[model samples]
Target: MSKCPRCFVSLTSDHFAWTQASGTTTEADPVASAYHGGQVLSRKIVELRRPVDAHAGWAPPPQHAELELGGPVREVCPTCHYVLVDGWRNAQVTCIAMAGARATGKTVYIAVLIKQLQLLGESWGAVVEPFDSTTEATYRDHYETPLYEARGILEATPAAHTGNPYQREPLIFSLGHWNNVSQILVIRDVAGEDLENPENARAPWLQFFAHADGVLFMFDPLKVESVTNQLHDLVPTQERVGGDPRTVLRTVLGIIGLGTPNLAIILSKFDALQSLQSVEGSDWSRIMSNPGAAFSRDFSLRSAPYHDGDGQLLNQEVRSLLKKLDATPMVMSVDQPHTGRPLPNRYFAVSALGESPVGDRLHASGITPFRCLDPVRWVLATRSVWHWQ
Candidate 1:
């Protein structure tokens, strides 16, 4: 048995739809035998383990539609032709879609997030790697090289179908094996510009959000005046780029159109807030000074390993933090449904670069991510997948 990458359903040899090579049905290969425990698994085991059918060619019965909270199937995977929806997969992929106005650190966060995950995965004895040539090439040119190698913020991700469409490619990581089964993680990064552009909402490229397992909605705190005003004395003022977060967020939810993916509302570029702790006579100065608080701590350099308890506590703290930042309404809209359906939601704060760069160049410390793994780990834990020892 194998699983659908889009929806973690087990595909048995009997049930897997096969297309004949050379366009001859007689020449089609039998479904590949999958290893289970020790002996090969039966087709019954695969069918019984199937999670949900949300791929392009598969259709869920009418009862499933009602259980899915009246959400719409927004897109089909161009490669697998999988119709993307909630409960599509049993393996549980953490699909965190990046969304914000331009230059809100969406690209930078992605660059850092991957490195952070690579480090975190090591503790579980899993070696994360790109699933294919497409994943490797896209991650290198768009994400890995510019930040990790050249030590600069990544150039804005090019739009889909342009000279560069790497962000559109999924970055897949192998999570070793668990319970005699191998686990894989797939992450997709999207351009903030595409999310912000009103015209792009209806465009095909933006359709991924509707099928994502999770979305990390980034809100830049630098866009707030009170925070920026206080920062001038300590840190140089940043050039304001990007549209209003509220506007972009609303458009994103609209584009998703009632799809029930877990929403991870994130505060990006949190280094500026960290800087406030040392400043005198400021409200933010006192807030960040609390040594016992989760935000005051750094997991990148600390002994803490990623998991649920601490993560859930941090999630609550971040939601409260966002509320204080006056982003409660935006958070509520994604979580508190007007149509009487509540979506699974979490909140996170991340600093892609430990410190802000003077211009396009990175700070001397390079990129040290903070709380970058929260969204992905939360999604993974939900599936109870474990890396091999």
Candidate 2:
């Protein structure tokens, strides 16, 4: 069964609600507002359910919305009230949620991830594109333009309560077909302010992370006092530094509760750490220059499959690196989650820009992503989908 792309909730064929598809005035919908964490204004809603002991098989009265109260109707999720896309019921959906503190390079990573996915899709003879109009427009305006075209830094994602926030909708992409079934990828981005507040924990709105197919928690190396002190003269000054990643991680884990989503603790902007190799005579230099370490190489683009051997190597290497970076508390939280049921998790390192920006502009060299796809592919491989040929 496919899940609702917006809410990541499992969909059922049993019964669903529908609203006029056209010529209807939008009004406040409390049910959707609850799931959205804000006021959701939409068309009037109507529900249809199968009668008990109806028959061996049952279907909606009509696939089309001719029996509409005001106009043609479309199906919606009974839980979140999200509209179901055409042929959505036939596809398999994978939901991924992005979580991290502010300035963690998440927006930069996303801008590059789509392009990489499209390039990979072409090589494998698979069609990959935005699944909906909102995704197309949002990606182009907010994500694609600033980083790729303007060659500048992206601003912090606006809070969810702000006017016209783009992150409210999920970025859904059609990954063509895999395993003889339609493959849909849904990525949801959240504002760091919301999660960093701590007050937001245990709130119903963040339930998406708990229910996600995978939740990626990104840690910023720049936030580490030791890393910053060592590289202060080597790298450009950071304009904005987010709150402690540990606090945000705890809040996110609190939201995830006991839900067993695969957690990927990604080390973002790892190029900054790699630059430590030049800090001669330091412990980081010796560690980063190991030559045999998995972090020393980039095999993400070359490999068609997500090899477990390589992934586990990188995972262990990152775990050790985190300890050195003073992130032991972050590691222990995942290793022994207070939820009592420790979730399946792995560590990954990704350099979205490959090089730090020179002020607001990108480095003179063109953008290059280092192992940005590793975390995503790790999640996909678990679902047995999109093993590139």
Please report, in order, the local distance difference test score of every candidate based on alpha carbons.
Answer: 0.63, 0.87
lDDT by residue (tens digit), candidate 2, 241-328: 8888889999999988878789999999999999999999999999988999999888777537987798999999999999999999
Count clashing residue pairs in model 1. Answer: 10
Candidate 1, residue 13: the lDDT equals: 23
Clashing pairs in 2: none
The true-structure Cα RMSD of candidate 1 reads 10.4
Query: Which regions of candidate 2 are displaced past 4 Å?
Result: 50-58, 61-71
lDDT (C-alpha) at residue 210 in model 2: 82
Who wins the TM-score comparison? 2
lDDT of 2: 0.87
